[model samples]
Target: MKISANQTKNSLFQKIEQVRHRQGKVRDSHITLAHGSGGKAMRDLIDDIFVSNFDNPILSQLEDQASLNLASLMQQGDRLALTTDSYVVDPLFFPSSDIGELAINGTVNDLAVSGAKPLYLTCSVILEEGLPVETLRRVAASMKKAALKAGIKIVTGDTKVVHRGAADKLFINTAGVGVIPKEVNISAHNIQPGDLVIINGELGNHGAAILIARGELALETNIESDCQPLHDLVETILKVCPDIHAMRDATRGGLATVLNEFALSSQVGIRINEESIPVREEVKGVCEILGLDPLYLANEGKLVVVVGQENAENVLSAMKSHPSGKNACIIGEVIPSPPGIVLLKTAFNAERIVDMLVGEQLPRIC
Candidate 1:
């Protein structure tokens, strides 16, 4: 039986509405071990939460794996970029964003900084026993919103429930796939002496925000996590300078770690101007009080960019023009001396070595 286009559309909307109604019933409910038993309960949980929120043609198929048409994807770019990240942020919820949003954005940024156009994501969640179903609902909703904002789809995912104490309240892991254009050639090894180093914005807000959220610090400040997806931002910069030397999202170890990786990979010295490095006043105060170096803190919505000297101005101008990179600035440059080392030149005319973190400064931070 052939159905008209209008009939098909109406049928889809009705199915979506039915799923939404099921979600409401589980709104104030709690997740049980049966929800992960791969039975009727599991189906109900998935339909009421994930499927209802992330409805799409591919996902609606409800297959074990999502199949994509090679010809259709190949038209987008020449190469494929894949990345995976897990979010175990201590507090599932934070001021600016939550674990669900962080998981989606983090994976998207990973693909974006690799010079790729994020296309799809696979989310796997580990739910602890006794977790509120409402919590999962909120997280799923946030993930849906974030994926939509990033112009990607969560085509496949898995959910498992662990015994109490076997897992935290919840943990989410996301794997993403993206397409990279043939002309874009970005790599840490491409960094050269005289290449200018740039950062998208202020540092350490995510780390500080997480610390405060954990109640580890008594002092309060209006700092929030700089958690955001950067594919659009990267696209803007690439439009201006396609030959960027290196680009990385400052994640766990922050900008310092990213610079160290570049220095080591390119076997060149990176000199950063301590004064020029942008650190928000509130973040600086939190760092000062806690004896933490903002340089070593984590950031989600920031990127460290390295570009040729001649294209530095153009790239910086392009970055600054974008909302995400409004605070972008050239904080340093790569040099030939002291190969494989990062140096911070302070305003007082003193140079100090910036090394990779020996151990985790802050754990369970996305």
Candidate 2:
């Protein structure tokens, strides 16, 4: 019998529901090497876990690579931005987010801060033998939710299992593609002297959260990772001030490192006011106890913005209007003297060098 279009749609929904319900029913609680051997076990694992959570037409094809139509993509913008990042945060899970969410947001933010409209992503995971299937289910679900929240799709992916000791419980890598509008010209080289430096919210929350979650601190606080995608925030800022000099998501090396990079690239000095840089009291306390500087601590959701002095107030106002940038403030400005240096004007009226982080502060952080 031939089925009607509505009947076919209903049948597909039923099958999808069935697949979703079978998420954690794997016979083995822990992953095995056979699950990555490209055999029936591997197929079943992918079908039961990743495919079930990340259900979409493009991904359902299960092709070796996603085939994207260029004509549709080209209609959005003139340039394409591609970024890839890996998430290996320890503990695999954290208070506000996990490795899966981090993997998605990190890649999305990378494309977003480059003045691009993030579109699609590819995910690849390394699963350690003996890792719980339940853990994988949770992570995959988180990734699916985050991708939907970011208005993007996980169109393709791969999974592999390694010996228990050969890998962590779970590690994820994601690559993203975005389109940059022709009018948006953002780059560190575009930074000119007198440009103001602005940031979208408090710093070091992600690094602090990860450190506390490690259980080595034996301390307690309400701090959580500021892990979030910044594309909407960037789009908002650009709508108001399209001529912004530069933008960067302060990630592994944090705000200080970003300033150094800007200073060196533009051949200008950055003078920041320590008092103006926003930091939550909880993060500050953690940094104090650990003897870590909040300036160098990593952040997942924060952004560093540079705009001409004339547009600083307007840009700050635009940023403040966005939920993600509500705590935005002007932290510094570009200076002509002493090129390739970043100086901090302390609250005490003293000056010090804000240099790049020399060594690893919090390893395994996103």
Candidate 3:
């Protein structure tokens, strides 16, 4: 077979055009201002770090807004649930988790605690100029893995680069949308006397993990952040006890903050025994040494659940059967008197108020 020179030139031109249009690797080692200028550099960054990892049909179109199927969402439930959060913890990478996984799990927990089946998520990241491109790739890979494990998709997102001195290493913001069934209604307003206070597992792991990551205290211990998605655990609870009065993830403000919110919202008092609350010995040692209260520490995967007295045992049993709620326990019960107050009964038979955090205990603990 004989090929003409003109045909060879035409083939070469077509191949070059294809390479220019297709998704490819980012060539720069460190991020620059030009990467966020809506030009070729930005496209390369998104294609290499984000779109390639968060590959999905909706995001593949490269549109400004995600095009969703209304009928598809309706099939899951009658109502839509939405939540948004930002992650700016110092030291973007921590033990067992990073800012990327934290952002996905945090938003998912928000939706799950509301009795919604998490469906989709939108991710946006602010990158400081001069950040290593590998760091961005690592974060994007983690987000992809976390979203995949949670059975959710990243449908749309944006990226911006700031001056190196103006911002930290990297920050991520995420918004999630889910579907809430008609039968499920979980809220703080539904709390009442005779309800049981339940927590999924040990508290303060996240705060302790972050503190250790920051190297503020000279300590040594094997502890990891309890960062995880909780939709499955919530679903397990819904199957057994659909009439949950109130439920919330013990996140930034931890167990005390959540209990106080329930009490104030429902105008009822919550009494929990100190012995019933779970805390790792390492965490306790850290708190005790630092003269800090573990109850107010942050947690990424723990939740405070309040259910009717009749359904308390059933919910507890169901939660214990799940992976996230293995240490589930009823720490307290709602009392009729002293509305808007949370009473913590110490192990020595003494009691005190458990109030919301007044000021920053551990900064940037997200």
- Name model 3 segments beyond 4 Å from true: 1-24
Better of 1 and 2 by TM-score: 1
The order of the candidates by TM-score, greatest first, is: 1, 2, 3
* Total colliding residue pairs, candidate 3: 0
Q: In lDDT terms, how accurate is model 3?
A: 0.92
**What is the per-residue lDDT of model 3 for residues 1-366, given as tens digits with 9 covering 90 to 100?**
899999999987875664455545688889999999999899889887888788777987889999999999999899999999999998889999999999999999999999999999999999999999988888988999999999999999999999989899898999999999989999999988998899999999999999999987899888899999999999999999889989999998889999888889989999999999999999999999998899999999998899999999999999999999999999999998799999999988999998899988899887
Model 2's lDDT to the true fold? 0.91
Query: Hey, what RMSD does candidate 2 come out at?
Result: 2.3
Q: Give the TM-score of candidate 1.
A: 0.96
- For candidate 1, give the lDDT: 0.92
Candidate 1 stretches with Cα past 4 Å from truth are 1-12, 25-28
> How many residue pairs clash in each candidate at the backbone level?
0, 0, 0
RMSD of 3: 6.2
lDDT of each: 0.92, 0.91, 0.92
Best by TM-score: 1
lDDT of 2 by residue, 74-178 (tens): 998999999998888997888799988999999999999889999999999999999998899889889989999999999999999999899989989889999
